[model samples]
Target chain A: MIASLRLRAAVVSIVLLAVFLGAWHLATRSTGTAANMSPEYAKLMGMTATQGKSAMPGPLDVGAKLWEHLRRPFYDNGPNDKGLGIQLAFSLGRVMLGYLIAVAIAIPLGFLIGMSPLMSKALDPFIQILKPISPLAWMPLALYTIKDSSLSAIFVIFICSVWPMLINTAFGVASVRKEWINVARTLEVGNFRRAFTVILPAAAPTILTGMRISIGIAWLVIVAAEMLVGGTGIGYFVWNEWNNLSITNVIIAILLIGLVGMVLDQILARVSRLVTFPE
Target chain B: MSIFDDPFDADSRVNAGCICGQHRSPAEHEHAMSALRCEPVVESQEKRYENVVASAVLRAVFPEATTRRAFLKTVGAATALAAVSQFFPLKTATEAFAEAGTPEKKDLKVGFIPITCATPIIMAAPLGFYAKAGLNVEVVKTAGWAVIRDKTINKEYDAAHMLAPMPIAISLGLGAQPIPFTVPAIENINGQGIVLSMKHKDKRDPKDWKGLKFAIPFDYSMHNYLLRYYLAEHGIDPDTDVQLRSVPPPEMVANLRADNIDGFLAPDNICQRAIYDGVGFLHILSKEIWDGHPCCSFAASREFITSAPNSFAALTRAIVDATAYASKAENRKQIAEAIAPANYINAPVTVLEQVLTGTYADGLGGVKTDPKRVDFDPFPWQSFAVWMLTQMKRWGQIKGDVDYKAVAEQIYLATDTRKVMIEMGLTPPKDSYKSFSVMGKSFDPTKPDDYVASFKIKKAS
Candidate 1:
């Protein structure tokens, strides 16, 4: 029954995508005659426009551009114009660096916060205050104080990603089964050993859940952050294409961003699954 | 100082001939030696240490044991140099300019808002001017005019493509954190246009623009001031009669199409782009408002100039060279191609060509060629700065009696710019304060207060 449901869901997704593309194509058809404007203006409008209306691209235009980008994703013409692969690498490199930093600081600090009531109580107000702020709000302050745009971008990601993991790890550790700690205590398992063996295994699933949440939030924030910073990233690429009024390139970037985000989420989900056990 | 060439004495280092060794004539030596100034001259002279660039190039070029010596000894330095020149142009290139004291900082990032007014600043990178001057410079495409100013202020950018009015505003601490900024050279002149949406093509006169929405690149930009002046001269109050918003040059066309703005007085290729897309029509070239009006400028902070003078000089040399190269009508098309890639302006090649080549469709069915339609003369005149100050005063941007000449002379690096202009073989004007006319009204630098007070349709002062 589940397998049938999965197959049906896949079919439905395909149908929806096809319908969307068909609608897009139908909606953007050239409605105006081609001869009203001068030859000069017509040439400047590219293939999208015939008359005076916008050449906001259809699916066909995006698909062709997407294919072009995929064929040569690593071409580096210069500093300002890099291929999609290079741009993605720049964004991913920033994200991973920021994410790893968050992990290193979060997990250990979160363990302390969860283990000790005093630490958790002390840190709670700060986390509550900081968590709700939009990541891009921190951008100008970071750029000003840090005096480095790239590092500031990374710093924003780290600040934004740290909160969820920290909260979850704390929650997971605090809610561990009491019997596991008692058992370890009775057997003369050292404090470090108890944490590494019993508490860790019990809390692993919840901690992984937090990490997954953080990764999703991190990916979302990076696009906005890079767009605001405007250097080299998928966000910059999208903003740049928009500046040039290339809606086709923007569509391609959006598709790639969604695809990359899904891959990131899936990898985190896989890791979460690896640590999960039956009740 | 030892006048004699004592080979055994360590103080004397072989009165080094020009690296090419072909031009040791008295005239050539005079030319080369005049370029090499005395010690403690430009910014990078104080590593207080070694000649790292030359040694590094030598080490990288000849890594083999004793190969540099062997090449100099056996193969005869000239032939070896001839072979090396194909790869690195060692024989022909000016080594002085490369090593010119040492760059205190090499890898520099110059910020620029993506607009064709920044042609010289942007084209210099792709055309190898920066590299030729022994600097590894990256032209960072900034999102807006405000960001460019901020980045330059925060030291994130070594220099920036600023509006000619910006450094003056920045130095005065108007609408920004007070940082002493200096304009080394103007980037482009007379490259803006008043473009209206296609709906208003018939509404050609400024009087028809009452309650019409308009956009300018920045308030501190010549675009805004010129637009204001043009409107006021036609008895239209820009403040009340029409609306003006500051949109980035890239978004001007889209805004026009979206009906967000009825028109804009903005930098190219934005004006050209609007004409190209059929969304907007070119109403008037900005040169019609004020011929030889200054636009974008290559600006650096006082901190940058004071700390890295040689680097500053080298970078300015590259910019002046580029500006001189761009000033010529013949080179405009190739410059358009050079900066048309995705990395730079990212506009269509045809759009860039039309803007640069000065032959563009007026977006109203007629092709026009005003050869000086858009130009690149990088002279940062003191009088231009004074005119901007008066405009700034004319608008409510700066209040309180401002001393025009002192501020203009300080911010506009006319003397330094003159030195560079002369070095590049383009003769700068004899006096930095030359008068110019705007809309049939002549502006005298001696009386800015009179100029500001002469305006009737001003914001209530």
Candidate 2:
């Protein structure tokens, strides 16, 4: 019965996609041609004036462009024009470097805050204030202070991802069961060993959950950060296409961005699942 | 290393002693010699041209090579130059032949907002003008005017394509910190237009545009001042009569299509793009208000000019060369194809062709041809700065006492540009200041205060 339900759901998803594409194709079909235009003038008018094509690209146009991009995804023409693969690699590289740095700093600091109530209260106010400020808002300040556009983009990712991991790790570590700690203490395991052997195991699932949240936020913010500080990234690609007013390329970029974001989330979700323990 | 050292004799060590006995060993002397050789060996452009001209004159004077060599050996090279100068105007010919010097720093990054006003600067990168001037320049497409200013001020860019009034505003510390900026060359003139949304096709008059929303590229731009002047001349105050927003040129067409703005006064390429996309129509080219008005410029900080004078001169020569090339009507189509790629302006080739070639569809079922819709001229007139300053004062952007001429001369660099233009074989205007009329009102650079007072619908400061 469950297998049949899964099959039915997949069929419905495919049908929905097909319907959407059909509507898009019909909506953008050519309407009426202007026949009286001179050949010289008609050539300059583009397809919109001569053949009566819509300004918006049809689904087939977008699909063809997407296929063209996929065939050779790493061709770099210049500083402003690079293939999709190269742009995605640049954005992923920035996100990974920033996410790793955030993990290194936040996990350790969060452990300290979780173990001591006083320390948690002291750092709480600072984190609370920083957490609500939009990541893009920090761009100008980062660019001014960092003096490098690429590094500033990485810094924005780090600042944005750090807050989620910090908060979740602290909450998980602070809420560890009292009975497990007491048993470890009675066995004379010492503060260091007991915390590592017992407390770490109990909080592993929560820390992984925090990491999943942080990675998702980082992926979301990288696009916006890269758009603001344009050089070579998927965000820059979108901006470049937008400047050209190529809506088809922009739609393709949107689709690719969504696919990449989902893949990142799925990987983190899988890792979090592995760390979860059954009582 | 000594010339007197005998290598054949076992007792005499040739490689052991310095030539002048100034160093410990021959190796050290050789190292010192190489270091000296590395020091600026590339001659100045003028010097190189002079040598070539002097040699040609000597060859003409003596058809036989033996006789020319004998003459040079007897009189020496300096005496030959002195003799040649007596008969021929060698100095004047050399000045004419001198194109550009070897750049002190060849690899440069120039920031630009994607627009037709940056034609010379953008086209130079692809057409090899920078390479011809011994420069390896990368023209970067920036996001907006503010980013261009910041990147240039931060030294992230070696120079930038800026609005004609930006250098003046930057030097005066209007929007940003006071940085001594100079406009060595105006990039293009008469390249902007007022593009209105398609819904406003019937509403052609400025009187009908009172309650409509409009966008300008920047607050301290020629677009803002021109739009304001045009509106006020039509008996409508820009500040109170309509809503004005500062939108980047790239986003202007999108905004117009979405009904976020009713119109915009922007670069010609942007105006053309809106028409091409079937969203907007050209209301009036900027030249209709003031023919041959300055729009955008090639700007650099004073620090850059002082520190790297040769590179700056080479850059200026490249821009002037490109401007001269673009001014011709025949080269417009080729330039449009070159800059339409994703790396530069990132617009459709047809849109760029319409802008550069000045034969375009006006989105009202009519094809119009006005070759001077956009034109390139590298001369930075100080009078343009004076006119902009008067508008700034009239709009209350500047307050109290002002020295218009001093500021204009300080930022415009008209005299320096004149020298460069003469070197490039392009004839610049004889005088740096010229009085012109805007909307039937004459503006004399000598009397800026009177021009400001003449404005009836001013900011009332």
TM-score of the second chain in candidate 2: 0.81
Question: How would you encode candidate 1's per-residue C-alpha lDDT over A33-81 as one tens digit per residue?
Answer: 6656667656654443346344778888788888999999999977778
- TM for candidate 1 is 0.83
Fraction of native contacts (fnat) of each candidate:
0.46, 0.37
Candidate 1's C-alpha runs over 4 A off are: A38-54, A116-122, A177-194, B1-107, B131-134
**What is the C-alpha lDDT profile of model 2 across B1-461, one tens digit per residue?**
22111111223332347774534577866664432111111334456456666666776897665666666667876787788889999988776566445567989999888888988999999999898788999988787787788778888899999998898889999988899999999888898999999899999989888789999999999999999999999999999999999998879989998999999999878898888777888899998998878899999999999988889999998898788778878889999999988888898888899988899887776789999899887878899999999999999999887899999999999999888765543335557887878977888999999889988999987
DockQ of each: 0.29, 0.36
Per-residue lDDT over B1-461 for candidate 1, one digit per residue giving the tens place of the 0 to 100 score: 11111111222223345443323355654553332211111223212112223333455787753566655566664565455556764432344434556778889999987888899999989888898678999999987777777778888899999999999889998887788999988888898999999888689878888999999988899999999999999999988888999988777888888999999999988888887777888899999999889899999999999999989988997887787678778889899999988899998898888889988878776778877887777768899999999998888898888999999989999899877644443335546786779999999999999988988878755
Runs with alpha carbons beyond 4 Å of true place in candidate 2: A33-41, A49-51, B1-101
TM-score for candidate 1 (chain B) = 0.79
Which DockQ value does candidate 2 get? 0.36
**Candidate 1, residue B449: lDDT:** 91
Docking quality band of candidate 1, CAPRI definitions: acceptable
* Cα lDDT computed for each candidate against the true fold: 0.81, 0.84
